[model samples]
Target: MAFVILKDLAYQYPSSTGLVLENISLQIQEGEFVSIIGPNGAGKSTLCYALAGFVPHFFKGEISGEVEVDGRKSSESTLDEWALNVGLAFQNPFNQISGAKYTVFEEIAFGLENIGVPRDEMKKRVEDAMSLTGISDLADRSPYSLSGGQQQRVALTSILVMRPRLLVLDEPTSQMDPVGTREVFGVVRKMAEEGMTVVMVEHKVEWIANFADRVIALKDGQILIEGKPNEVLTSDLLIENGFGISRYTSAAREARKRGLWKKEKLPVTLDEAVEGFKS
Candidate 1:
């Protein structure tokens, strides 16, 4: 059975007249890592919200059709209840930080404390999550004292400590430097390997190619393409629609026209580009 099922899902914000999403249907199996790619205003962020149960519940929007996660219908469950099954981490980690907390550790534990988790278990969960995200050393640092990347790690650790079955990420590494971006993506990949489902919306085509099990491209709130990472990321439709692809893919496409690249399929990463050109 699919862990996340969205059938004919449509949503429009309270302030907006038109739907942000329309007839969006998809099924994500347990432990799958799905990456969503789209141009600006294509409703990628909105789709992440729907997966995280913030669409109709938290956003108070007009929603139609079904959104079910781990067999629980989003409309049928309260926001509080949905939190146990889905976690959301977005682009602005600074906004996610609770200024009331004195230290990073406290901030990470805030969610668990509010949900009435036992103290002993809460501490253990936070420790594990920090370690998983490679932020254990920053536990005692002030949340405001950290750099943008470190703060993003803390934001993600805060959500991860909840042990939600499904994690929804919308450009979680957008603010991070290259090193920090890799560190955060490492944690995300590890979580999927350990059986947590993840839906990530990212513009980093190379990272998506490396980690995502499947890729879905969205256009105007509807699915434009859905398939293996290699297929969707390198498809001509994305290029025509003004979606960004890997630099390697772009260069390879140009080279192919000049009869410089003999490969039938374009490469999405540097390694593939080198091999494709050599062969």
Candidate 2:
């Protein structure tokens, strides 16, 4: 069985007339990195909430079907219990900052302190996570005083310190620049390689194409396509449906039509495009 499984999952908010997520079913293997992409209001964030056990547990909504992670069902577990094995980072880092902490180190250590992790162990974990995200220098700074990208890194570090089995990220690098984005993606890729299952909602097609093990495209609260990143990120269907795609894919498509590109598959990353164009 897969490490993460969602079977016929559907959810609706109290104020909404229709389901926010419908007929969603997916299986993710242990240590796999899956990326979700779609336009606004596609329910991508809602799906992340469901995976992290906040859909019904915290959102107070109608949720049907199963969300099982490592044999424990979200429906059966309390939010606190489910949170131990799943960590979620929001798109906006400000939403994650805890005002109670005076320093970034304390902010990142809050989760560990909550579960009564030993003081020494918590410090070590927080320090390790900070270093991994390249935020060790910001350890003493106030969380509120940092820039958007810096805060995003701190938020991600906070989640990383928990060492969750599954990590759910909703545009975690949205506030970062190119260098920061690459660093964050590298850290996430490393985490997946080290046996963490990851589900990320992001619009950075090139990075997703280069790093994610699989791609799932959502539209209007339903999955429109699912496949390898090379196929999904370059699919014409994505363009037809108004879904975001890699710019290299777009350029390669146009070049192909002009008989300037002869590749059987379109490129989704800069390197692929350069190689194909040079051929």
Candidate 3:
């Protein structure tokens, strides 16, 4: 079933004269891990805001066409109402953290409490969320005192505590180091494995190309190409759209130049590239 749907969607800011998104149409199914990649201003974030009900509600914009989450129209819903179903994690983790005085556990439980989940249920949910994000050890620490990676994890746990059906991550690992980036991606993959639909906007093609079930490339506020990671990452269309091929894919291409790998299918990961070498 389609968990989120967009049809001819476009958004125009009040102050700007042009559309941020132009004629976008796509459907994301339940429990799919998809990545949206593009240059800086390719409407990637605009699409995220539109699907999360932030464009028309929070930003002063003119919206056309239709956006639906689980068959519910986005225009008919408020940000607060939609937030229960869609969890958004921004690129800057520090901007999302609130209540600096609260311990990590309290921060995670705060949203659940506001939604009127019972006390016992809230406790279980908080614990489960922290565990899933690997932040159970930091539950008693203050958000300000934790490392940048830990803070990001806490922010993620807060969202996970809400038990959202769709998780929208906007460069959630953009600010992290190599280790932290792996940590954030690990958590994201685990959530997807557990049946949560994940739509991420990321610039790190190498990492996402290996894990994302589907990859969509955008250019100048429009989708340029989309398909399985191997297919989309290897296409000339992606290069034309300003998306770099994954390192492994590039290596495979280089190997093909040397006649080491005769296979026509491109590799999307280092493991696949190594396997190609063996073949």
Candidate 2 accuracy as lDDT: 0.94
Which digits, one per residue and each the tens of the lDDT, describe model 2 over residues 130-202?
9999999999999999999999999999999999999999999998999999999999999999999999999
Over the stretch 140-210, how does candidate 3's per-residue lDDT look in tens digits?
A: 89888888777877777888788789998888777668777777777888788988999999878778866
**TM-score ranking from best candidate downward:** 2, 1, 3
Candidate 1: clashing residue pairs, number = 0
Estimate candidate 3's alpha-carbon lDDT, on a 0 to 1 scale: 0.84
Over 4 Å off, model 3 = 177-180, 258-261
Clashing pairs in 1: none
Candidate 2 local Cα displacement, residue 201, angstroms:
0.7
Query: What is the Cα-based lDDT of residue 236 in candidate 3?
Result: 74
Question: Which structure among the candidates has the greatest TM-score?
Answer: 2
